[model samples]
Target: MFRCARAFSTSPLFKYAAMTCRQYSFQVFRDVPPLRQMRRQLLLDRKTVGFVPTMGALHEGHLSLIRQAATENTDVFVSIFVNPTQFGVNEDLSSYPRTWDSDVAKLEELNDEFARLGGDTGRISAILAPTPKVMYPTLPPSSEVDGDGSFVTITPLSRKLEGASRPVFFRGVATVCMKLFNIVQADRAYFGQKDVQQTVVIKRLVQDFYINTDIVIGDTVREHDGLAMSSRNVYLGARRRAVGLVIYDALKAAENAYNSGKLARSEILDAANGVASRVLSEQQALSPSERALYEVDYISLADPDTLDEVETIDPSKGAIISGAVKMVPLEESKPGEDCGLGDGKVPVRLIDNLIFKPRP
Candidate 1:
């Protein structure tokens, strides 16, 4: 029987005095050899593996995936690598949330929950928390366009929507994920719907690459107020956090509007844009200075599959209405001043989406 190390119980992060949860320890590997060896052992034992890839900073949204994996597969491997490749030059790679201690605690919490439910114990058997150096020992030379270092790319799909905004984002995502898929060799891989396009891209990647794994997408988890949960959400200041709700509200409105028999693409876009505008207007009215803090990047209606703009929603096929907004915290500036966001303002970009399907 696997036993947790006594040190974990006394560790600051792993202390469970709050509740009488079962104590257990899963192997954590920092290098590739041990991880691969474990996978080999699992394969030799004829056990199926479910994989959950994450950037740490665990939340309920992430927990749902782990729970689903534990319930379905004989073994679950959760990777806690904060992949640096995915972040853009101007992105929050440095400032991105990294609560390693809290993350491990959440993993422990899930294992205990699984035990409490009489589900298979020790389902969460491995955690691969490799560092950038471990994942990629050598950096690409600067002269190369993308890089002399190896990378994976899914054309067309990688160049659309989210990719359009952050050009190299999907390439990095595809490369790292493909590496994970190769290393884990999981029977099933799980993803969340919060990143709708990313899920689509990964699904396509699996199909095209002929990887022997099933891709499962969990529903997007939301806060009580309907705001989609995200790791970047920690960057949102109080007012900006409240203001960010507009994305969800806007998507809900768009879905409702599509259900109301208005199929025109322009009309649907206008509906979501209107809701977002109203939310922004109200916030601005409450405090005019907040106006500079909220900016709608784009509101688009597109075919869910191809992600191309659709003139009409084929209720049978379904469609997606999505948008991104730039939310910033208050920066001290006079009413007539430029707001000067570079100095004190904390800006974070948020994205949300909704799917509309007509009733059959």
Candidate 2:
């Protein structure tokens, strides 16, 4: 027979012991705590916070900013307040999508993921769920009077583009954003380049008001076919969607002309118009039902910073090409025919921009 110690070591018990030891060498992970718990911990830990303000119908475009914030900042806060003051009387504020449940779900999902990755979940907070009365105190009855305004007015680089169309828009945006910055106390803020004008105005506001938030701008996200990602794109029907490509095509034509030694502003505008005209003409050939329906508002190229119309591309200064098109509805009668709608209006406004930076 074998010695007792040798027999014990060589037996299945010894093999099982070895296996258990190997398994023990590897680490076991417990389930991560929920974001709410992690956030509380982070807040207690004293982390710096960043913010992104949006009218939520959150998309990849918005998520990209959050991801950037996650990488660079200790905390991230997103506010989703659609301020009524920004919208014109005839604008789509009434029909603008507001999916609060889904928006909160997305924010919570992002917060939890960040938390699991050891990021400060408390940093990625949202302030959209509060009731109107609680968030904005009731104004005195006289505050609505012609000269009894209680809200502070922000005079920014308005009087152009969306500002020209919606005069009171930027004032409202600036005021609401000021409130958001005060509430969040963010060290940095993220904005997409799609709204170049709005970006300029916000920068001015921060500077003039002495707000201490660092602004970061993300690239404008676009569809595979080059149409800029926008919430209003949902309103486009089949034909209108096809016609929508004209905007992108026009922008590209203008860019190509600028790059290929064509410096004349008129020539560039002509190039854009050429592309738009071709598409419009083709659509006009189709039956009213088959044709895409839209009204071109304006096409312009301007200095990205000053927002003034630029005749020549300055290699040092960037330019922004922007325009708006109104979409007509399907099931409505022909262009001149009234569908009982007063102005024959199906305002599916499409706004897009292309930003050009000089080569190094």
- lDDT by residue for model 2 over 1-360, one digit each (tens)? 111111112232112122122121111111112323434565677766667787877777787788787777776767665566667666777666565446656766776677778733333643333323323556521212132333445454677887777776776677678877766567788988877788888888888889988888888888888887776665564456678878888989988887886766798889888888888888878887567766777888888877889888776775888887776665444555323222333457777778777754
- Show pairs that collide, candidate 1: none
Task: Report the error of model 2 at residue 8, Å.
Answer: 69
RMSD per model, one decimal: 5.8, 15.6
Quantify all predictions' global Cα lDDT against the true fold: 0.77, 0.66
Residue 252 lDDT, candidate 1, scale 0-100: 84
Per-prediction TM-score to the true structure, in the order listed: 0.87, 0.78
Off by over 4 Å in 1: 1-24, 120-122, 140-145, 286-292, 332-344
lDDT of 1 by residue, 1-360 (tens): 343322212334222233233444677766777778889999999998999999887888899999889878888999987677777777767666667668878888888788788746437888887656666778831212265566888988888778877877888888889889998999999999888889989999999999999999998889999998888777665556777888888888888888888788888888788888788777766654444457888777888878888998787888888888988656544446443223326578889887776466
Regions more than 4 Å wrong, model 2: 1-44, 112-123, 140-156, 331-346
Determine the backbone clash count of candidate 2.
1
Q: Point out the worst 10-residue segment of candidate 1 by lDDT.
A: 5-14
